[model samples]
Target: MLLPLRRALLLGLATVLGQIVWMRLATGQVAWVQVAILVGVTAALGTVFALNFTIGHLRAAREEVKRLGVNEERVRVARDMHDILGHSLSTMTVQLGLTRRILETSGDAALAAGRIAELEATARTALSDVRATVSGYRALSLDSELAGARMALSAGGVRVELPAATDAVRPELREVFGYVVREAVTNVLRHSDAELCTVRLGPAWVEVTDNGSAAGGAEAGNGLTGLAERLAAVSGTLEHGPVPGGGFRVAARGPTAALDPAPSKEGEPI
Candidate 1:
């Protein structure tokens, strides 16, 4: 391929030769009027070429922006669905197992029926959440997720210690923290054999700790990965690993700010 500068020089030389040949053939001499006409034609062709180049660049840029928007929406939908289905299915599995155990040990139809009802409610809520996610209208509530964590943990036969209220958490941080709590509790139920699970909340942080070792099941999964992304969107960080001696802990910490002057008290056992 010719270098750009060489190509332009060659084209200019060719155009000069072609114009000289034309002038000699048409009038046997160059005239200012003919020269002006040639210049005008060349200028018009150059303007057309520039306009076409510019239009092509603009079209390419528009397509790139459209592709990026589609990819972003896909990521959002996948994350929301992962959060919804992971927790709901995990809760149902635990609840179904509990109902089976209750039926086997005591033959209590009423108790089993009650557990089934709870499972149905959870399923219905999950369906609603999925719909909301698809419509791009879903916003998680810290309070609701905490209630869900309590129910799910209890069904899994794990003792839970949770804050009496989430009022201490900053308003802007609550949604991401809600995601943190949901993902953390789901992991504890599916991956741990803990006897006690505790959730601590503060103005800029939330932590979920379980007394059960993960038995090497502490690797980050879809839930944790999505949770980390959600936290990162809010300038927050996610930390998860085995505790000093045993068990596992997952925490999301946001930027340090004086959102609360007085710190929250310790969570009470429920």
Candidate 2:
């Protein structure tokens, strides 16, 4: 906020000082007209400086809002984790206590053994969930991604069209597609002012098209650049261009072998 104002002030002061020196050198005396011109120039520069300052302040405020939103999401995730694990651990502890009590009371070895097995399974399941969450390697399901895209577009009041059964995309291709979908949705939310968004998946290609203004000169942010790198990693290609009728389209393609099957409840094989 202050940076732009400071810069403008410095520029205006320099300009005014230069003009004063030039006038002193060129003329014997400083006239009232020169004084009025200097005052007017200073006022105009100050107004421009104020306008630039306001823009900077607004940008800072927007960034602060985004930061606050991210913080809120983190808090919500932590609370959910605490609730889930707390309950699971409490139940497991109770089961263990019961098993111990049975062993001491009746020496019922068979029942105690079964209870111990149950406890072990529960603990293992909880551990698996925690590991999955921490690893951040979520299984990418094409169907789920399509559904999510549909929901997002609908919520944005944009109509969506999807094609029929697409082939089982390769594991690597699926991951890349996941990133493409994410970036496309983000662009729609942030930049597009469209009445419709379309997602099409074919045997060897996936495309996202929106009926919004073209984003030709817009700068690609880190998210899109990172996604492009991911695609490049698998020898896949990503392309963005303007559509004939209007708006923009993003397409990504790669070998089908890149897609992986959904992980089983038993978890990934070691």
Number of the predicted model whose lDDT against the real structure is largest: 1
Indicate the TM-score of model 1: 0.81
Summarize candidate 1's per-residue lDDT along 206-267 as a digit string, tens digits. 88888886654478778888888888888888888877667888877787633433222222
Query: What TM-score does structure 2 among the candidates reach?
Result: 0.44
Root-mean-square deviation per candidate = 5.0, 17.9
TM-score of each: 0.81, 0.44
lDDT of 2 by residue, 6-25 (tens): 68668767877777777788
lDDT of each: 0.84, 0.64
Error of 1 at 216 (Å): 4.9
How many clashes in each candidate?
A: 0, 9
lDDT of 2 at 150: 66
Error of 1 at 91 (Å): 0.4
